[model samples]
Target: MFGPRHPLMLIAVLLIAAAPAPHRPRRIVSLNLCADHFLIPLADRGQIAALTRFARDPEISAEAARAAHYPVSRGTAEELLALRPDLVITSPWRRAAIAELLRGRGVAIADVPDAQDYAGIRANIATVAALVGHPDRGTALIARMDAQLDALGPARGHGRTAAYWQRRGFLTGAGTLVDDLLRRAGLANLATRLGRPALSRLSLEELVANPPDFLFAEAGPVRDQGTELLTHPAVLRAVPPRRRLHIPGALIACATPAYPRAVANIAAQLLAADRIPTRARSQ
Candidate 1:
């Protein structure tokens, strides 16, 4: 039989083992723009360790002004570790190495899924809410969103039956989020008839030759570039001037809570372009 250790020594070892881990984190860091939006509102100002630098750019984040006061980093693992965050919230699309490094250092990592539709967006809001111990807030947010969506009313049927969306020659086809938004706004996407996926590239010549009743063009920053694409000299010469509307590219990119606003804007723009004088055009 082995000799017994001293009672004092054994007691000291047990006490040390029972002590809570010192490396556990109490601060949270956000690594993406969407996560920033979800987490910032849920977390206390003191609890937020850092946010990505891009979080301050209004072009990418609508809550930039509110986020400007927080500590910001370039989304590198080294920078994240320097902040000593207990938890890191990031998009699923973040680099694997950053996640691995944080995990290796015993930091909790929450990889939020990309919300591609209305349901997915609601689920994502709940997920973020749970992380910040504010599930009730998530429910409230969802309720508000539901109310907004419900107020949209049934899809109207007065608009042109077929429409083409030209975004730098890429068309939004059936089954895509943009297509869903268009359908919700009471416009038919012509891309589906062409038997294409979410997006398909079509030449300006082809578009002019077989133009749909309505054209929604996504104009970029430069008016000249958009003018060249929409009013291409060849296209201007060939196709008769019909109804053309410009939709800012940002509105159609992300499936966020602001999507309903985007849908409303697009619907209003379409109604204006269609010259539909009915009061129903006041979306």
Candidate 2:
């Protein structure tokens, strides 16, 4: 029993003021797709308030299966406020307006940066983990990713070039996650060699005139005009089916824990291509 103004009471008050603030956000909401990727694996399931609707779509999200279990928000202010999120994780690249709106209302925001390479990936993971009050979990996830990459061994591209040819002839260029992934597999990005920007479209004729050793096509059914172009006769002739590696759209959709999976898949595909005859391989 100490009096209110006692020296011991005063010291206790000062100590309490100096203590670190708790960072455990119990009601976290994710507005960015990339944020959704990291949130699903790092944050406790109970800590999550909601994820974006895209989080449940397997075609875009690597953690779609797990994210499916969480509630989803369309990112509308009303919807987000109703969830009473202690932390809102989002990207400044997209949904800046929504994030700004939320901020004006006094919501705490964690702006997740765009990860263009593996180092960025590690940083993003760490940032999200710490935000969720689980820095150890972030470190562990990064360690696991590093270990898996080491076990996977060296790059297997063998100086070959490839183009991440997307629907409608769009080529993924330098400084992008796709380009970094290509380098990891020992392959060079044709877009960089051509002096193309981060995202640009190459016509069918240009593709035929300067075809790379391989075409990194998106894996999925042809569902529309965009996807239809991927399977056009011109594309098949420029880079034969045998020389094409159809990676899952979800894998490259974002830089997340699934990055290792994408790397492994690329390396495996390149290894398989090695066993083929030089003439057929070039075809």
Candidate 3:
């Protein structure tokens, strides 16, 4: 005790004491489906503290099965805070109050913007990658996406002159992601052609009077009771059967890497419809 420790031993002790600890994310909470997509694929299995229940809903998420294993959390401040996550990821659409509360607690919150189209999807992917410290992986994923787009080749003018989207009376207009997807698939959006900012609810009479060359509606069971408009006898009588196509809601709603595949599916259907005999065209 009276003598000083050996210089080498003291130096070794100081070096051990001053050494930086390894960085490992201990807890992560994802508040939205999009964030679920980004966080689940990138984070270590045990690192994910919670995920949204919607993340396991196949209708909304492409990787639902993978996301189902994690504990689910609703987008509530108290629930998220209880998880004590080191990092939280959410979409812009998440409740503002929850985001505020988390930020107030000094937790790092990453707000990923909603993707309006394919490009926006890439941007969101990159942003999430950077936030999670996986910038290179993000770049590679986007490169693969760009490669897929490149494979689509020049757009052919084989689609119908006008196409109608009949999803819950909401029309995808110019400057919207659906409109851009339609254009990429070689179809002209009737909503855009009519100079409408987006879809204004139109009556069955209006639709019958000026029918689009093609009528596409959500393929699955109607969610809203009002969706009876799609199958009303009057609506059916007004629309020629040959002009209608049922597109899966999953194809059009989530703007993810799977979106290009959805566009391809739509384009294939449109091309097939174009081959129908003129006699079969809607009168």
Ranking by TM-score: 2, 3, 1
| lDDT for residue 155 in candidate 1, whole number 0-100 | 56
**Which regions in candidate 3 have their CA more than 4 angstroms from the true location?**
1-24, 93-96, 154-159, 162-164, 220-225, 232-239, 275-283
> Each candidate: how many clashes?
1, 0, 0
TM-score of each: 0.75, 0.86, 0.78
Residue pairs clashing in model 1 are 25-86
How well is each residue in 154-215 modelled by candidate 3, as lDDT tens digits? 66434554445564566567776677777787777777766778556666666666667667
lDDT of 2 by residue, 79-152 (tens): 98799887888878655675667776666787888889999999999999999998888999999999999998
lDDT of 1 by residue, 124-228 (tens): 888877776667778888888788767867654254544455546777787666777767777777777667787778778667676665667644543655445
Candidates 2 and 3 compared by TM-score, better number: 2
| Candidate with best lDDT | 2
The per-model lDDT (C-alpha) reads 0.68, 0.88, 0.71
**75: Cα error in model 1, Å:** 0.6
Q: By summed lDDT, which 10 consecutive residues of candidate 2 come out lowest? A: 93-102
